[model samples]
Target: MSLFSGSLQKYGQIDILVSNAAANLSIDPIVSMSEKALDKLWEINVKASIQIVQAAAPFLSDGSSVIFVTSVAAFNPGTGFLNMYAVMKTALLGLTKALAAELAPKTRVNGIAPGFVPTRFSAFLAESAEILAEIESKILLKRLGTTDDMAAAAAFLASDDASYITGETLVIAGGAQSRL
Candidate 1:
């Protein structure tokens, strides 16, 4: 009901709605990630997205934007570590496009698929500083991502400058396996 409250409080005047919340239980092979794992991921990453969009739809004005935060793991089947996490992210990409089409010209919708940003979500990968440094070594930039990197992209997409773009995904993988 945060969605409903945000709408009610905003008084049907939302300029932008960004769904940035996510959750991940464990990172193992798909065969090992079980029903509970799948259910938890679906609840947070998928259902909540639709629920919040439904809540925010009434508040959004024409030309408003909706940005869904996803991950490069969607296309890049991350490590064996991603498991169900990667699948949910991939589903998010589809959801972004589907929602964009559903919203149409009134509201522009897009997604950002960022690489490994250093955050609590990825703390699982770096249980310790040693591991964190180890993971950083693999990135094309020779460093992991920062929250600021993602913030800038989202800010730009939601801004009036991106008025013509919709149903697209901007990847922020630090030159990690990108096509020219």
Candidate 2:
């Protein structure tokens, strides 16, 4: 909140809002997942997103864009130990849908689901070259994603190119299956 408030105070208004902060707090089975860890995960992945949107709402107006960085896990439910992560990402989808309606005809709301990005946040999967290759093999593009790729998609969605697109989750997963 402080960072956002500081930015708002500095800029007075925001043209685009992207809620991309998330953490993999736990990977244990649901039966063994700690309550504290669960709360922390929910706080970062879901609650913080809502809070950011509310804080930025006053500055947003028509033509403004709000993009939530969800994940392919939201579309694919059975992602092994990422079940909880998947659930949280799915919650973002719901938030996107509802917020689109609430802020409609004004600020546009959308989401992007990037798959197997080789970022520090996904070190669990991208830490080893072998694992990265294995994951990339699953993508039709035969490669892992990059931050720039995600940024390009976001730029399009945030620009006038996607002015008519709202309440939709765009999948930038290198041709990964995203159908629910």
Candidate 3:
């Protein structure tokens, strides 16, 4: 928070805040996962978001937007490995809605759930071309999402183009199933 505070002081008020920090540790059955791992996931994926929004709220005013970069895992639990990550992402959905209500008529709170993006963050799932191809096949778009894709969505949400949108998450999973 100290760094956030310093940034606020240095840069002035914020127009858009994107909370995209997350750590995806080992994935296993709930019982098989260690307590420390679970705690780390909760701290980074969930608690950090709460702290960020709270810290940024004062600097954000009417028309500002807050976007959380979640994952399709929130709605579709991974075979079993991503159970912990999925749960924490799911919690962000609730936080998005609640914060939207709290900052309503002024700031907007929303989430973006991306699917099978071949970034280092997701390298664990797409370690090879064949593996990535197999995963992309499931997406209707037949391609992995790109950072540009997410950036476009975030830009729209931050602009007047999405003035009327709030308290809702935009699913950019390339037509993958993203419902709870």
- Clashes (backbone N, CA, C under 3 Å), per candidate, total 0, 0, 0
Tens-place lDDT digits, model 3, residues 1-180:
554678777888889999997898877787788999999999999999999888888889679999998888898765557888998899999999999999998799999988877788887777777777777777998878999999999999888999999999899989987898
Candidate 2 lDDT by residue in tens digits, 4-62: 67767777777899999798788888779999989998999999999999888988856
Q: Candidate 2, 37: how far from true, in Å?
A: 1.1
- Per-residue alpha-carbon lDDT of candidate 1 for residues 1-180, written as tens digits (9 for 90 to 100): 555665466575788888987998877677777888889899998888888899888777899999999888878665657757777888888898998899999999998988878787787676788777765676778877788999999999999899999999899878765322
Candidate 3: residue 152 Cα off by (Å):
0.4
Ranking by lDDT: 2, 3, 1
lDDT of 1: 0.82
Candidate topping lDDT: 2
| For every candidate, C-alpha RMSD to the true structure in Å | 2.5, 1.7, 1.6
Clashes by residue pair, model 3: none
lDDT of each: 0.82, 0.89, 0.87
